[model samples]
Target: NLSVVVIDEAHHYVGSLGASFQGLLWRLERLARHYHARPVIIAASGTIANPREHLQTLTNQAFVVVDDSGASQSERTILFWDCTRDPKTPPSTQAAYLTRHLIRMRRSVVVFSNTRAQAEYVAMAGSDRSHRILPYRSGYSAEMRRRVEHELRSGSIRGVSATSALELGVDIGSLDTVVLNGYPGSISSLWQRLGRAGRTDLDALGIVMVGGDPISRSLLANAAELLERTPEHAIAASDDTDILTRHLLLAAAELPLEETSIEDGPGATAALSDLVNRDLLIKDGTTYRSTKQRPHLGTPFMEREASYEIHFQGTRDHRAVERISIRQALREAHKGAVFLHFGTPFRVQRVDSERREIVCIPETEGHHTQPALFRSLSQGRILEHLEPHPTLGIERIEALVVEQVTGYKEFDQQGRQVAKRKVTSPIISSPAEAVVLTCVDPIYLGIDPEDLFAGLHALEHALAKVLPLLTNGGTSDLASLTLRNGDAPSIVIYYLTKSHPSTMITKVIHNLHEALSLAEHLIAACSCASGCPFCVLDARCDDEVIDKGAALALSRLLGKISVGTALDSSGDEEG
Candidate 1:
């Protein structure tokens, strides 16, 4: 019988994982009810803004929050290193240097990178004969990860470069320093990574190496603000239709789901009806049963996607080296792309889509590959709208997004572009939801069509950097594009994951005034003469079309009009 349940790192119970966990909790609660046993659940987290609400949403139980237990923290020396000041050295190289230096001082360190590929790259760059650094991420096999954890605990290894996979409550012995390769995208995450060090009441050092991204650069300019900002609230879409459908199917397969149970959830009733219509579930009397056998075996609780097996050319019998998701395969395991495994590089020989396999050969050449993508949006259907002002309109719409990888560029070990190659690849398309900001009149703002597009485009990039502040998500969680509809230009901000609900976009539309105010402040606070990555320029976009002055003017106009003020008739805007 389950008496007590403990959930550590409860902050991570968001997104698709959170949705699955919610369904599991419902099942457990029903089981406990049948057994006449009341189980107590304890959810613990480091530092999240909405811990109480987040836990309540996940488990559907009221919680009395315990904010503090009279615990004391060790002194941690936090340093924000502006790597952009010295553009000569890349941030990863600088991080490697810091790792080596810490190891030399007999201080165990953990360098946190944002992505798996970056973790591998940093590990490869930092490792030396004297001190060996290994990469630790989710992509590695279970045995490999355990080996690295054991080595770190026993002091067998000096350092490790890892992604967020290591940021959780994993016991990896003690450490003296933690180097953040870039802004981990949120304040809560920043503190969580810093907490990795100074675990045993010992003074520790934490370094934040500012990256070239706009958000990282903005944080560099306003380090005090970053340090003092409130932690973002954690949000989870438990009522998402797709997620609810999968979980309801699993629930029915576990035990015939009762009609009352189906109606208790937010969208479970409709999902169950759809499943019944599709012949995946059958209604017998008052309960529903799944037709498929062991539905959970085929259903993944995480984001739905196919996995691709990677096979090395010269291996004995050609055993699979690693397995990556299809999304990763398209970006990293495409034909001619350089795939990294355990700090070693391999050039992808072929991507067999039919078999869902990637064939790669060991790459002797020391270079990295970056994919170039072509993305477009179509078939927009408006879901909700808010006309806060006469000149501005905010609408949430569902649309179809198609993305294709057209080519890739190769960069040498020194971080210089070496060559560019074009390749044909399959196109991936999905349905997406977005929040669009429509600018009614560019003439009123005293800008031509060309300048208006540039201004809106710059505003889109700026918004992408700052929206995370309000949404409690990463910069990569949303993407933006500027398009013209008839006479008005609209900025479209959409989620990166297709299964994500419209809650995030809805939040943006509701608090657009705040978002616009933050965007304007971000652009104006920068000291650059024109535009730099620190402000209006996004490194991911075409830099030639970005106009800093026009962006500032448009942002000022929008900010003014959002607060019920009309545009000045004289058209003498001071930006």
Candidate 2:
């Protein structure tokens, strides 16, 4: 019997599909009840709001909680540092920046990037200037990651940057300072990642770098407030069904599954027998087995990989092959090549072979070629037809994604939402509900041809210090996006469409939207009198400098435009 339980990355385990461990969080709660032990859960996170509630939802038990405020309240500084998006974050620059601060400290420092790619990049740059600084991520073989962890323990490695893999309960000895290139997505994630910085003998010195993304900015700016705030945790429903179902079959595979009355479930015995008679379960004496005839009777709900073969189209040859990632496919797609695939059946909109991309908006249901995730968010499912101005776990959830927050919002002396600026935002993406959409782009994309060239260059500079925000889904998926050049030519946009329905698509669109909007919003809100912090465009990129009004205008237009079918070069929809 375990006396204490510490759920490190506690924010991750809510929905049914999140992780198998999520099931464990639920099961542990049930086990506690079964054993009549009142569980105590102490969760630490970066800026995830409502720690206690998040706990309650996961454990299914009501409990008391304590909150810790990091000592850096007055010193919790946020900087709007600038860098090239192509990630010209030089090792020399990073090393110089840190050496100035922690060179004197005894313990080392840890840097975090959400993705393996960025983590590798930052680690490489740092190691070039320093001695024995290592890169830690899961992409490397288990041995490689283990070696990195081992090095951290021995102190041969002076500094390290890693993916979220290191954010959990792994011990990396003690550290002096922790730096984040951007605000981690949730409060819990933030604390957990930062917790690795300071420990035992040293003070917990954790610093966060906000990527030029809006979400990152909000998380960084209000993290102290967010950290100090209560977290709203939700529980997954009907989790025990899987447990009962699995054990029932396990028992059938071994011995006769009968209600011994010791099992406490009454109708379970009759239910299994009835299922056998109905041809759902096959009874071989006291044991029951799923009918081979039913094919999927004993299958797991989340269809494991090897279920489908992805086919990606080659731009140069116009030949369809297996699915590839955006960074690879976009560079390869031929100009004006058509993008199509079969995740859930989707109608092709437009394709850019040149950009190696596709643009699509969701079509009403035809054939769900890609699987439809359960719409887990209330705003997406319940509150439709209203412009949402959500507080982002603040005063209230109004907009799904906030663009501009206003109305001089003031919190009373009691730290409540008294009155404040009515924050306007784009419908924000929810971590819970994952939705799918189809989009298309034309031959030249026609949004702004030159900006297409320039924006790519700009993004590298834009996201220099920003965290990679793949909120809606994964980063390797196909995507469609609009861009602008400095009076070089008309604005152009491009998109890549994949037929499969995966979270990758959502991640692509959300990251693109977040990247452009954060830059545009900060630029527009600031390029005014006194350069308001609210709109300081404080992020690294000065999108407004490139085309201030145009960027904001484009972002707003995207929010309002209803998604439509993609138009072929001749402006005809693909049949």
Model 2 residue 258 distance off true place after TM-score fit, in angstroms: 8.0
Model 2 gets an lDDT of: 0.41
TM-scores for candidates 1 onward, in order: 0.80, 0.45
Q: State each model's CA lDDT, in order.
A: 0.78, 0.41
List the pairs of residues colliding in candidate 1.
none
Off by over 4 Å in 2: 1-8, 17-56, 59-107, 211-575
lDDT of 2 by residue, 380-421 (tens): 221112122221010111112112212232222122333332
Off by over 4 Å in 1: 68-72, 211-213, 252-269, 272-298, 314-320, 378-399, 433-440, 445-451, 458-479, 483-489, 495-575
- Report, for all candidates in order, the number of backbone clashes: 0, 101
Candidate 2 contains a number of clashing pairs equal to 101
Number of the predicted model whose TM-score against the real structure is largest: 1
